[model samples]
Target chain A: EPEVTQTPSHQVTQMGQEVILRCVPISNHLYFYWYRQILGQKVEFLVSFYNNEISEKSEIFDDQFSVERPDGSNFTLKIRSTKLEDSAMYFCASRPPGLATFTGELFFGEGSRLTVL
Target chain B: EDQVTQSPEALRLQEGESSSLNCSYTVSGLRGLFWYRQDPGKGPEFLFTLYSAGEEKEKERLKATLTKKESFLHITAPKPEDSATYLCAVLVAGGGADGLTFGKGTHLIIQP
Candidate 1:
């Protein structure tokens, strides 16, 4: 089965440095998303992207955060300045067409663990 | 706000044992309910999607049922490989753009 793939399985960055996480969603998928899970915590939605634009975002996805589909296959999330609280596992997901509702099933990547110090 | 609450934060079952995990939600308009399994240091793996109340889906030894206010994931004759954290999430009608509102998840351990 085809699956979502993310790069840099793990990353360590300084508190004020920039960090970017990359994902390559399923080739035919139309909707892409970014979510984060703090250690031992529930997964939290960050943002959703479709048609090269942001569909929605959460409070956690403030000005410091940005997402880009620079190419047909790559979806990237960039954080301008990392903070200690930003340490978490960032996951990328994609949804294929055909579901009646926008809330279709999602395929998630293994995730990228970000550690900010 | 959409919220999901999964009950019995943790559970342990002996091989061949059967049990259920519960996920209750409060949302404005229900679009879909989803179940996912997650292993340590990995992303969630989608299991099933319940679109409306009274809908149910099954896979192997696992069965998922949905009602108006809650959903249940039943594991029958479970084995050690069934051990993992089960996450339940809700997608409200107009809340699709924000993605899923996930619960804290239920940690299940099946011992062989």
Candidate 2:
């Protein structure tokens, strides 16, 4: 079974530094998303990307956060300046084309753990 | 705002025991309800998608049922390997590009 793959399984960055988490979603999928889970918190949506554009974003995805699909296979989330509160596990997910509207079953990567200090 | 509440923050059962996990949701228009299983240090693994009220899906020893206001994940004859955090989420109609809104999740432990 094909799965979403994320790079840099764990990252530790200084406060005010920049970090970019990368993901390679399933090849044939059309929609991609980013979500994060703070320690002991529920998963929160960040943004969704489709057709090289952002479809929707949350308040948590503020000015400092951005996402890009620079290539056919890579989806990335960049934070301009990391904060202590930014520490969390970031997940990348993708959904197949035809099933996008029929179900909410998203295939997720193992996740990238970010630690800001 | 769409909200999902999962009951019984944690549960422990002996092997071969059976139980159910509850997910109560409040959303404007229900698009879909999903159930996922997550282990430590891993992302969520999709298990079932219930699109409408009265819909149900099953896999192995797991069965998921949906109603107008809530959903239930029933585990029958569970084993130690079934231990994991079960997450429930909701997709509301016209939710745009936003992804699913998740609950806090229920931690399940099955002991032999």
What are the RMSD figures for all models against the true structure? 1.3, 1.1
lDDT (Cα) of model 2 = 0.94
User: For each candidate, what is the lDDT?
Assistant: 0.93, 0.94
Error of 2 at B76 (Å): 0.1
Which candidate ranks first by TM-score, i.e. highest? 2
DockQ of each: 0.70, 0.79
Q: lDDT by residue for model 1 over B1-112, one digit each (tens)?
A: 6889999899999999999999999999888899999998889998999998999999999999999999999999999999999999988776445478999999999999
The estimated TM-scores of all candidates read 0.96, 0.97
lDDT of 1 by residue, A1-117 (tens): 899999899999999999999999999998999999999899999999988999989889999999999999999999999999999999999998676566547889999999999
How is the predicted docking of candidate 1 categorized under the CAPRI scheme?
Answer: medium
Instruction: Give per-residue CA lDDT, model 2, range A31-64, as digits (tens).
Output: 9999999999999999998899999898899999
Please name the candidate that would achieve the greatest lDDT relative to the true structure: 2
